[model samples]
Target: MPVLRAPEVRRPGRGDPAVGHRQAAPPPDARAVRRRRGPDGRRAMSEIVFLFPGQGAQHPGMARELFGREPVFTEILEEFFELLDGEGKRLRDDWLTDDPAVPLDEGRRAQPLLFILGYALARTLETRGVRPGVLLGHSIGELAAAAFAGVFDLPAAARLMEARSLALDGSPSGGMLAVGATPEELTRFVDPPGRPGGVVVGAVNAPRQTVLAGPEPRLGEVERALEDAGTPGRRVPALQAFHSPAMAEAAEVFTAAFAKEELRRPSLRIQSTRTARAVRPDEATDPGFWAGQVAGAVLFWPALEALLAEGDFTLVEVGPGRRLSTPARRHPAVRSGRSTVIPMLPSTAEGTWEFWTAALDALDALP
Candidate 1:
């Protein structure tokens, strides 16, 4: 229930594409539309997808209390530290407290730690009889989702995450920004001269929340232009320009990492960004697909569209921040109809265990 504050850091400096602008315009309607009733006058049966948020969603003290209370949680944490810390030193200190010396903010520590914590939280929820019918994840969170869907064991996921973080270290300095426009409008905004180094739409999050990633200067210009145009926007605190061409090196590293690890078929369905299709663990193991994911925009829109087509689906956003859930709740199928979306992280005064119990009860209560 504690509100963890981000460390005070300066905004990144200018780079690559030069800045530009335009006059303010009306903001796009970012609200979710409700679905009208069908001819049968009955709502459809609902399914569920366990959604995971990535990277910036992590905070310093996430799951520290949970680790203290649960031995299983502690075991997982220790295992993660062991895998990451080849020197056999404790990595727990970096995550458990707010000490600045450990530098939990770095991509190397942040990615693996987030994955372990997310997995622990998902396991905790499962202990309370809460399980998703399907799994989906955004960005790095996809690793956790793959594990949850039984694509790989926790150890394999941990190694993959560590390799991913290391591969991304010292990469180019491009960034991502969430835009408040329809995908079409945003595409125009990021096109040709409007973009620097040819900024690409990274993720089509929702009807109104598409993310654009590219050179830092170009991204800054786009942000300023959006604000000046009366379109509310914010920069996602991401180190590398993920899902952009800039990540090709990281993708290659990820491919090698996966090739070294033994991958098995997933027990549950995994929605892949590379193929925009439901893939099994074995299929996901294709080095090309894993590598392609780094260079490709997350097909979150397709994943969501697939879920909606299933008619009824309860969506649970697991982990510290609410990035995934925020955009997902705005979907017409999830908002105006039978589906339910909830966060597993403790965002309120109530303890997470309490929240987990309530979420299970709510799921049970769902028709």
Candidate 2:
């Protein structure tokens, strides 16, 4: 009885497929620049720009609490999981609610569950008339954003998540260490010129926040070095080091699977983490573009810049965890500006009602 209302999977021949091949969009009106003052001589929210989080952000009893508490969220999530099951990928975790019986933190279920949570939450927001003018995700979060922007439907996205995770399963086991240091400072430790190890800058979240990925054993040395230098370095609980050269084989497998998918032109702007720009129609569909994501550094900082350039936008972190919001709120741009960054769900044990109300209140106060 769950509501299965996700948009139908559009095909090239069935829908307006030519839209993705269009040339780069013209720049926004110069008059559309950020307005320091509204008619009341105060700042105002002009648009909603969704920011999706990746793996490290997820925790047990996340969106599930929302499902158990909110009828709409529950229906949509259950329906989406049904679709994913139809695609031969099952939600190994009891994702519709926070069930203590099913362990939710397993690696095999992370990507798919996160995608469903994000996609379903977006759907819930739409029922309240809150649509994203721009969309961006943190690392693995981009996959969920892609689905939100019509790159693919839930079914195709489910397949991609499973295939990508399966491919990653074949890669050597590794881990990621989050450091409160710039990529420049961490360079020498990552795959240095003369080294037997293979570490690399996996994600560039901000000027000072970068994630280093490599064999778990090698990452220990890097962590110790950071500590010795008075820098903060903590391991992100993960079994496989993603977004590094260690993911080469996974990238190849994902590329082949991605090529077969039919990516639709987005109804709104969906920024790319690969190049830190709004994804063009062709580039959005290019298998090679998505392939690069596996082994390339996540340019989250630059992509955030691209999102802010589009006038005053409410950077809504529309997924579980504050991983993306934590840094974004501290980024010089957001910290200095009057812009707001609100998270849809808090990582704590608080129920989803307060957070959901917060989002509704924020959108209600928008210009």
Candidate 3:
């Protein structure tokens, strides 16, 4: 049996007490000067974007601490679990346990739980006067973003998540491998000059971090190629190949499941990492666009760049671990001190409540 361990959590940086000590958060600059204030004197959300992470970020016990400690997060999350019926109970039971019968990376296990947690966190932030100006998500995280933006109500999103689980269940055995190479450098192995390979670049997360995906056998070939080139590659926890041609059939299954569901235009700004732009009204209503996400490459770095180009914005990673924050910090805007990244929970499961409060306090202290 695979003994599930705590998710790989990065240590909080030193000095910054809010959201793990990092560089003492710089004093709020110009952005804070023009910020709007609420009736009770709390800062209103402005120039802030809430980011959500997808599959690889999840682990057992994620958000367990927040469930009971924070009323808003607890109620909203419990409602999502209730919508899932028996499956919700099962996921909740496994989530709080140290060991799970199935791995958390499996789509069936990961997708629903992630969607619930991400949506709950967004709502939790809103109640604390941390409403976001925009929403962004990577891969499956996009669905959660849409839900928060009102593209789909919670029940509708849950149904789509269920549809996704069914589609993944029927997909071929495949997985993703994260390589420390640029997408251009990895292209040769994916489809060398004369020979065709199953692998495709699943995501270009950062300048040097890329994710490759395909059928298990083909992925093995790419992994061996990486070994030959003396490059490092790590397996991203997943049972089905997402964001690759191998997901074509699964995409069809997923689309058909939600063909008749109503999808509304987002009430707030929401960016798509898949398209690397703000989602359009037509795209919001198109079921195909959402379904195609299963077989589309995630242009996270490009999307983040595009957003940063518009202007500096505070990025809040509202999911488990620091998966999205890790890459966001590499962006020039963040590195140059123009933008900031705040994580709501610590990487480790142990100090989640403490970290959660600290992060909120930090946000309140901004400006």
Predicted structure with the largest TM-score when compared to the true one: 3
Taking all chains together, each candidate's TM-score versus the true structure is 0.78, 0.82, 0.87
Candidate No. with top lDDT: 3
Candidate 2 C-alpha lDDT tens digits along 144-263: 888888888777876787788678778777878888788888876678532335788888888788898876677777778778778868877677777777777788998998888898
RMSD of 1: 11.4
Each model's backbone clash number: 5, 0, 2
In candidate 2, how many Å is residue 278 off?
A: 1.1
Residue runs of model 2 more than 4 Å from their true location after superposition: 1-37, 40-43, 68-72, 86-105, 192-197
- Order of candidates by lDDT, top first? 3, 2, 1
lDDT of 1 by residue, 183-302 (tens): 678755675532335577888777677788776666778778778788867777676677776677778878888888766677777776545678855576676665567667887877
- Tens-place lDDT per residue, model 3, 82-129, is 888887777777776778766788888888888888889999889878
- lDDT (C-alpha, whole model) for all candidates: 0.65, 0.69, 0.80
Stretches of candidate 1 off by over 4 Å are: 1-46, 86-91, 102-105, 191-196, 280-282, 347-357, 360-367
List the pairs of residues colliding in candidate 1: 24-229, 25-229, 46-312, 47-312, 47-313
